[model samples]
Target chain A: MKGFIDLHLRPNLEERVEIERIIKRAAELGYRAVGVSLPQEKLQERAREIRKICSDLDIDFISRIDLEPRNSLELLRSLRFLRRRVEVIAVKCLSKSVARQAAKDRRVDILSFSPIDLRRRFFDSAEAELASKTQVSLEFDMAPLLYLHGNQRINLLWKMRIETIIARKFDVPIVLSSGVSEAWLLRKPEDYASLGYLFGLDLENAKKAISENPKKIVERNRRKLSPNYVAPGIYVIRRGKDCPK
Target chain B: MPKIVRRRYIAVRIDSDQTIERKDFIRAVWSSILRLFGEYGASQTELKMIDYDPTKGLAVLRCSHKALPMIKASIPCITHIGASPVTIHVERVSGTLKALRRKLSI
Candidate 1:
């Protein structure tokens, strides 16, 4: 089996020091693959340098676009344009309408909340139901949990617990990420797996969130992007007796 | 029947721009545990700071085996000790301190 993957390393291109440190540190911490979230407009340009850095350390670099579409209409437009361009598409669900749209979109891989604002976490039972029918995974980031304190921290945990219960009930996959742009914020995979206990995930499911769930998301994207792909669980055979070519 | 006391040792590497003393590290870890798991979980952990090197930013901690997940969750929540930002990455965990020390060659 492949090693672990952290799907939300938000390394900014302007911060050269942070970009290098974040990628190198992730490699040292034992992540085999990482989905680097870049702004949609900057995706192609920013990927080159980050991909090179990751290759040096033998880390699989996955280009990811984090869409913060203002409305459902804007999300549809971005999904139409960016779906095939990036390996992973994570939507920053800031508003209720956007959250609902992102949750229901098959093109979207992860449904992420704002890191700084706890109020922006709009995930609930309705969103969970929308996400369950699709391939969308609810991302629970540990970065916010690290910095939030006192009552604010309690508030976020309570929200997370409720959302987690909802996700479990609807059978939506949950993906755990460091969700940190800084190198120092990066923790080992096992550490994040253990942190899963706080979110009401069992040990086995916690481990899977870090490894298997993310892996399946990437693999699903690859399969969809494959040239021979016809539809879900349907592919073309080029060399078989049933094949025309 | 006899009851067995299970213990685990964890080797952690601290990442920070400044040096962190053993006491501050302990305070941060303990505070995190209390904040997340409360006083009852704190008592059950049997948490102890066995060895610390301020210069190297390396430390070894001992805890009840059952509390391994508690230690793992608590340490990552410690983003700061006093005014300085810090992060602890667990490098290894073992049943015996000697085995952990051998693994780290310390």
Candidate 2:
């Protein structure tokens, strides 16, 4: 499985070299794909530039677009170019109304709800709004707000257990991300396993939460996924056809 | 000629008390002693112990050179091989090819 970082492209700072370097480093480290974190304002020009970069490097580029009206317009416009070149469009929906609109306007490879606030009152509503859609999926941010409440430190095991239970209940497809702000912070799969174990994550479910489900996003979008691919229950690159249940 | 790398060590620390059955005691500490020896380096330390038995309630650890520091740092509780209260010292030696290869490189 592969993972990526969001380049919070700051203005007036030359991002071309830095972005290229980051991509180069990622490729060297054996990442399967990369995603750009685009603010609503700069989607048009930057998407063009990123498309070019991805072409030159032969790496898959995914555009993570915010689901605000202003950003949606830019994303919708870029969808023409993106239809052929880009791998996936990650839409972070603030509201179900915007999500439905984006779904209707352009094909979103992945739909994620990254609400900064922790009320969770809106999740059922958001889930209901997109309940009918197929091919598009959801991701959990594991954000501090979601895991930790005021004056409380959340147990990682309990959180994983709960999320797995909830995901099963809703039959919703989910992906796990570190929500990392830096590049050097990439963690090993074993580390995630230990954490999952600490949080009551069964070995198979923990593997799926980090490795299988996230890879599904790329496999769903791309035409040429790697041959040595591992998926849910299937542990490739090893002797085992399936992880021991 | 390849330079010899420090591979393993053995520590047999003698402790007071000599009342309980020695063989069963050594069997019980076997797993813990091995685990502590393996975690000597970031990867596989690849250490091994030949034998630990009862002699005046003494504890003994046989491990690899790279694993020496870790073996040194660990509490004697793991290497304590006898039934009675005893201090154990670790003696280490160069491991076989399989062990060294497992420890070498990233």
lDDT of 2 by residue, A1-245 (tens): 35532212122214577667655544543444556665546666777787688678876665555343335565567655454444556666665555665544436655555433333213353453353255455554433322343233233324445645555555555555544333333233333333343334455665575566656656655542344445534434554565555
Instruction: Estimate every model's Cα lDDT from 0 to 1.
Output: 0.88, 0.46
**Top candidate when judged by DockQ against the true structure:** 1
Docking class of 2: incorrect
After the best TM-score superposition of candidate 1, give how far the Cα of residue B60 lies from its true spot, in angstroms. Answer: 2.0
Off by over 4 Å in 1: A115-119, A234-245, B1-3
**Highest lDDT model number:** 1
Candidate 2 at A172: error in angstroms? 1.8
lDDT of 1 at B16: 91
> Mind giving the per-residue lDDT tens digits that candidate 1 earns over A67-144?
888889999999999888888999888789999999888999999897568778888888999999996999988888
lDDT of 1 by residue, B5-63 (tens): 99999999898999998899999999999999899999999999999999999999999
- Scored by lDDT, model 1 comes in at 0.88
Ten contiguous residues with the weakest lDDT in model 1 chain B: B72-81
